[model samples]
Structures are given as C-alpha cells and as structure tokens.
Target: MKKLTSIIVLSMAVAATETVNAQTVQKRYEENPFTLVYDGAITRNEKGKVNIHPITYQLNGITIAANIYTPANYEVSKKYPAVVVAHPNGGVKEQTAGLYAQKLAEAGYITIAADAAYQGASSGEPRHTDKPANRVEDIHGMADFIAQYKGVDANRLGVLGICGGGGYTLKAAQSDKRFKAVATLSMFNSGEVRRNGFQNSQLDTVQERLKQASDARSQEAAGGKIRYAGVASITDEEIARTPTDLYREGFVYYYRTYAHPNSSFLYPMSSLLDLMTWDATTNIDLINQPLLMMAGSKADTKYMTDEAFNKAKNAKNKELFLIEGATHIQTYWKPEYVSQAVNKLVSFYQNNL
Candidate 1:
C-alpha cells in the first residue's frame, strides 16, 4: 500500500479522439429524453489491447451480470492489482461504473464494476429495492470474485464507489478488510441524505421521516405505486433560480447531457423505505483501511462527503480531494470531470495499493 502523502495531479487533454465519444453520447440523449442510452458497451475491444468481457456471477441467488476488464498485458502466470467500482444510484455498470472500470483496467488494474443487487442486471425479486446488509455485501462479494480471478493478487484488492455507492463502500470497508484500500468519487451517504438533507438539517426528527416512509409504504400496500418527490428533471425556471440544486444538476446529466439512455437501472420510488433504515455514519468508528474521498467544489453534497470523512476513525491512511468547477451529477459520466476524478483514484491506488 502507498502512503497518504506525496500526491500527483494528472492533466487530461481534450483530444480529437475523445470527440467521437462525446458526439455519440450527445446524440443518444438527443433522441431519448428520459433514458441516457449508450450506443455500445463502454468497455470495448482495443485490438492491440484487451477487450471487456461480460461476466456473470450470482448475487442473492440471482444470476447477475458484471463486466470484467483485464489489462492488455495481463498474464495468467502472475497476480495483478484490482479495483471493484460500484455505480451511482439509478445507474448501471454500462454507464459510469463500467467506464471507470474499463479505464482503470486499461491502466493495468483488473477492474470489475458490477451492477448492484435488485438494480440493473442483478437479480432481485422486487425491482429496485436496495438493502444495506445485502448491498454492502455486494461490494465485498465482488471483491471475493475478483480475488479468485486467475491473475488477481488477492492480497492487493481495493474498492471504489460513486455517489450512493460511495457511502456503502465505507460500510463495506469497516468489516471487510479484504480490501487493501478504499476510495469514493462524489460520495453520497444515501442513508443520511435520504432521511435528511444536507447535514441532517432538513429532517432532524426521526418521527418526521418515519411518517413519510410509512405513509409511502401504506400507499404502496393500497395498490398504488409509491412516487418519488426528489428531483428527476429540473426545468429552466427552477435551474435559473436554484442552479446548484441537486435535482437540477441531476437533470443536466441523467436527463439532458452526458446521460446514458441505454443504462439498465430502474429508479424505484419504494426503495426510500429501505433507505430510511440505512445509515453509513452510525458505525464510523470501524473503518481501519486507507480512505480517499473525492468531491467536486460545485457539488451540493460537499457536506455529505465532508461529514463522512470527519466521522471516519482508525483509518490507516486518509485524504480529501476537491475538484474545481464540477457538481454532484457532473462527475457521474462527464468525461472532463470524471477524468480528473478517476486520475486521482488511479494515483491514489497506485501509490498505496
């Protein structure tokens, strides 16, 4: 593992080659307003390099799909470093998770970005219902699968999460020391944020939250679908007034631009019930590995990331990186911004893992 100090900042140049991807992603969203579809697999064959192969594993006794990307130079004779990257809420591995995994894999790290249980390609009876015990288990489960891979070092395993996955990764790291290092990009403590917004300032009372979730459950039981109140697509009127609103930023990526229409996750409104029971900050004292938290300066959840970093204890190595001119959703699939975030991740893992 690497030390917490002596950092390096990598520069990303906008090359003409990147334009094709930009245009393709742009066109996909232009056609589909609700879904940000990817034209093809994010992990592809690079000829002289390796290809991203679709791999399946069982999670929760269901057949789940995962994309495993091995480095072009990977050989079965030796073990290599690996990272398990989880996607954001309402996202599939084909979107941001798969992209990060492929990029890191190309850089010589065996990367597996899997779809979480009950979402995307993973098997779950009730669609989109995420459980803390099971979801966190998903993170460690992926690590176990990677550890047994033919070329994995097993001892040098690491994990990463984006947004909601960010919070869950911490929970996974606390008990599952199998991971040598841990990092988060645009981290979101979903359990904390779902029950309360921005530092528990919005919903400070457990009774208030219980009322809402319970009411939603009752409505669902009455044969009505539980609806979501959070932001999905923000209008211009709302955006101009509250430009930094989480929903507004989410609209820019998940709906308008940089949105992958072909992604496979369904945003289940009822999952809030499960989320109401989840809280990653409750047991912050348990994490004992290296922790790297990355967030964008323009992101609203700066507090979410900060709050998590502050609560962490006994972590052998820790760091907090803030990227300029980016918001919460902007880091999801935005190439320019994600490049910076992923590079920090690569360097962090390189120096430590």
Candidate 2:
C-alpha cells in the first residue's frame, strides 16, 4: 500500500510538470514582430492617425474587455456615426475585428470591437462557453454601451459581424432596430454548420453526435472533468491533407502566421446541445435594416453567406458583393481583400447611415 501511494504521487508530479510546460510554450504576440498586439496598437495608431481606447464594462455581471476606436481629430461634442464590430469564433477583439475597427475609424467613424464573455480576456466561469444566446447578448451589450458613449450618434449606429459573429448579427438585427445598417464579411452560420455539419457532411451522424454531447453534459453535472471539442492543435501534414481550402488556410491563419495565445477554436462539448438546435437563417427576413453581405468568390463557406443573403427578404436595401479570387480565410488578412471589403463597407455605411 505504501508503494502504491508513492507511485501515484510521482505520477501526479510528472503530470503537473507537463501541464506547466504546455502553458509556458503557448504562443504570444512577442513571437511575431509584425503582430499588432493591443488596442490602439502603437505603430498603426500613429500611421492611421486614430486612437484606440481599451475599456472594460460589466455585461450581465461579467466583465467584458473591449476596444473603442475614435476617428482622427475626434471631438466629443460633435455627433459621429458609430459601428460595432463583432469578432469571429475563436477570435479575439484584437485580431481581425480590431483591424476592421481601426480601418473604419480611419474612414471617419467611431467603432468598437469586444471579446465575448467566457472568451478572450473576458470574465466568466466555465471558460470558452460558445452559446448562441450569449453571443447575441454580447452584440446588444455593445450597442447599449456604445450608444451612450460621448460624441456617438446613437441614431446612426451600424454593425459588422465576421464569420460566426455574422450569423449572430443577423439574429440581433432582426429585433435590434437601433442598428441602421448591417453587414457581414465571410459570414459563417455556426448553428447551420453545427446542426447539420459543415457543408452538410455530418447528416448521418447527428444522433450519434447528440448522444456524445448528452453524455458530456451528464459528466459535467456529476462533477466529472469538462470535455472540449474542436481543434486544440494541428500538424503540418494534417493541414496539407485537409480537403477544403477554408480549413487548410484557416489552420495557417489561427495557428501559425497570426497565432495568439488566447485565440483557440474550442468550446465545451456540451455546447452542442444548444448549438444543434439553433439556425442562423431562421427568421432572417425579420431584418428590416439595410443589409450588405460580402464573401470571397472562391470561399468554400460562401454557401452560408449565399443562403443567409437570400433569406434576408425584408431588408430595406440589400446587396451581395464578392471579392474576386480570394478564399474565406484570406479575407481576414490579405491586403487587397481587406482594402476592398473596407472600401465597400465605408460606402455602404455612408449611403445608409
């Protein structure tokens, strides 16, 4: 019995050492010299002649971290149009969302990008909870907070959601008329993909997957270990063998060139319970504001944008613009595509807001 106890103690010490090494070796902005790490990032802030204000506020009892970008020569007393930019799943406010906010602010608008609760520097228990309802509420919270910001013209507010956030923006805009214009870039329908599988590839295993999710939930309720799903890590050979450009390129974007420590495409396994029951296209026609949907012409996930755009039947003015010769992930960072999308967004918000 004494020998058995000693063996267990030694095993636990080894396990703890491994966990510490994993934490220490994770990626950071310092690894990439070109990484724009903070809000109102120093180098670009000067180049763009804009300012980024890092702020925090309470949302539903949780502290939310965000960045608000003000246009050059901003004046608190003067009325200015504002936009709320929502980040993609597994993405933080400081990444592509911040890039767009900075660009839009340079175009003479006040913009904000925020981390979702339970993710990316935000405070919440059971970290990485990716529920649809919580994401929608985050958008509303942004609107509520920004509408009251000094110099903002609440009457002329707009919204731009990227990837999964795009789907939630559609749902939020349906009832949140405070958003005068709504737009999406590379829109990905989380619920549709979760329920039926990406590109409808998991139709046969729906019940099997649901059972797994149910079992995970039961485990958590009984005080067992929390189970997570999605890509925690990937190898070069696996990415090379990936069948779709969307995921293959996405792996490069998230895990290599633009990697960040907090950015991960994971969610609790039990999240599938709510995710499988939700669809981003349902009631999409309820969006009464002007809508603009943009997707890369070659994006494998373009079908999601196409479906949602077609269903936004009641939008006051709707336009579908395609960026030629770019894939879904490329739109997030490639220079030409980013410029093209930003130019279109500027014009849309100018005309509508």
Error (Å) of candidate 2 at residue 243 is 1.4
Error of 1 at 216 (Å): 3.7
Residue 346 of candidate 1: its Cα lDDT? 87
User: Which 10-residue span in candidate 2 carries the lowest summed lDDT?
Assistant: 31-40
Task: List, residue by residue over 135-222, the lDDT tens digit for candidate 2.
Answer: 9999999999999999999999999999999999999998999999999999999988888998999999999989999999999999
Report, for every candidate in turn, its global Cα lDDT versus the true structure.
0.74, 0.88
Clashing pairs in 2: none
Tell me the lDDT of model 2 at 241: 89
What are the per-model C-alpha RMSD values against the true structure?
11.1, 7.1
Pairs that collide, model 1: 1-352, 2-351, 2-352, 35-261, 36-259, 36-260, 36-261, 37-260, 37-261, 37-262
Residue 57 error, candidate 2, Å: 0.6
Q: Which candidate wins on TM-score?
A: 2
